[model samples]
Target chain A: MNHNLFPGFIGLSAALFAIGAVGVLVRRNPIVVFMCIELMLNAGNLALIAFGRFTHTMDGQVFALIVITVAASEVVVGLALITGVFRSGRGLDVDELSEMRE
Target chain B: MSVIFGLAAAVAVVAALGVVVAQRTLYSALALVANMVALAVLFLTLDAQFLAAVQIIVYAGAVMVLFVFIIALLSPGAQERLHPLEARVLIGGLAAVAFTVVVARLTLNGVSVAASGRFYGRLGPFAPVLVDRHGQVQTLGEQLFTTFLLPFELSSLLLLVAAVGAVYLSRRRRAS
Candidate 1:
């Protein structure tokens, strides 16, 4: 097992992050966008854990745990909002929720 | 180790792309589930056994189930195709690629300069600290209770707030 897998891990994380970013950019459905956001969060978590592994510390793992908690809360709130929007008959399109921009 | 990492990475990348490219939102959620599982495998390979378990139980199991439940509730029948290759998507894709390149470079540079940032401790002799069935979880629990206690308690509070807020927000309003 080669010890130099840091770059590989980082690069893979970046690619996953990019895919997530593009998904958020192009997706119209709020649920899909939210899932993409989760993807981005996972990418960041992966990086933190990898860095923790490299640094011989538990800090990165702790941070990853925190991030996962935050993401779970985010999904809860976000889905609540989505359900509210759906109930209000606004549909799930992100473009239609621009009333706040005024 | 590298082979496991490579295979997991490949699976994760493909599943991530599938999440983005799938036509139906349900399919997208499933793809995200696959991506999350693959990521958990990657976490295992990284020797973060606690994290790997958390990723599987929390993200892959709970979070994805929530997503799939919401998709079922939304029940968007016959998925509408967005105008693929549109100007906005094109620009977004380019920006994403550029961002990835910059972040990748920064990561490599930071790793090279940071103390104890070498590819050590992740595997080999020190691997047992994390990969050991009892040791890693116990260490993580000790740290969670002692060193990281404040944040741990705060996260529980956060979850409480989220639960309350979700219920409040989703409740049906009575006619005034």
Candidate 2:
């Protein structure tokens, strides 16, 4: 707890997370939205590790590690599904990915 | 108190602006990568070597590769551009303004959080186990496998499920 740790990273991460989330919600492209989700995960990881260092807890840093793996898996699955939807409906935009109205 | 942190913050803001204003999707992706790398460097400056290492190795190296790969697969050039204005921007703009005010308030209120990235014997044996010396693989390895094994295993399962689901979803469509 040196008061020197994390510093601007916390606020930076928050801003980045917000930007990514805004992009995801605003965009209709599956690929772009996927990138945004990845951005969001990275932001969460940054914040987690910042807290980890402040509290002297390995739990937070370790969780950040776990998040990395989960994010990688998410990309793989999410992209593949995107590709599948593309092949299935022949539509590349995410607004067309869903068949349900509600 | 402000040299490195300020620089890092500046980079973050510039890269974030790239994310918002870049007309090209590929450019946005690269800008996002820049943001991540800048963040990882900040973690290093914070003294969280483990977190820094994880940031570089995982988020920067692995996850980013996956993202770039998807972007390549998607072929950004083939996609058409969306119009500049939308209702989502209205909501997002409001949220962003609120966020700015909250952060400004925190700094103004003098609510300071500790800054060290290194553990200081505060979290029982865990902190000292990793610090105090250079060699921590044994203890870290032990804790990861034994005490925190359940979540570890669950995480692996999640990755596996995500992988399989990705494969299944990406599979080619059979002709009708």
For B66-149, candidate 1 gives per-residue lDDT tens digits of: 989988878977575756578987888788889879977987676566436444524432355444645887777787898999
**iRMSD, all candidates:** 2.9, 3.3
**Model 1 TM-score (2 dp):** 0.91
- Fraction of native A-B contacts kept, per candidate: 0.68, 0.45
In terms of TM-score, the best-performing candidate is 1
Question: B107-156, model 2: which lDDT tens digit per residue?
Answer: 43433332232333256455644654644445445656887788789999
lDDT of 1 by residue, A55-100 (tens): 6677788889999999999999999999999998887889778999
For candidate 1 chain B, which ten residues in a row score worst on lDDT? Answer: B117-126
Candidate 2, A1-102: lDDT as tens digits = 345434456667777788778778777666777777877887788778766665655666667777877877877787777666655646677676566766
User: Which segments of model 2 are wrong by more than 4 Å?
Assistant: A1-7, B78-87, B103-132, B135-142
Please give the RMSD of candidate 1 to the true structure. 2.8
- Candidate 2's error at B84, in angstroms? 6.4
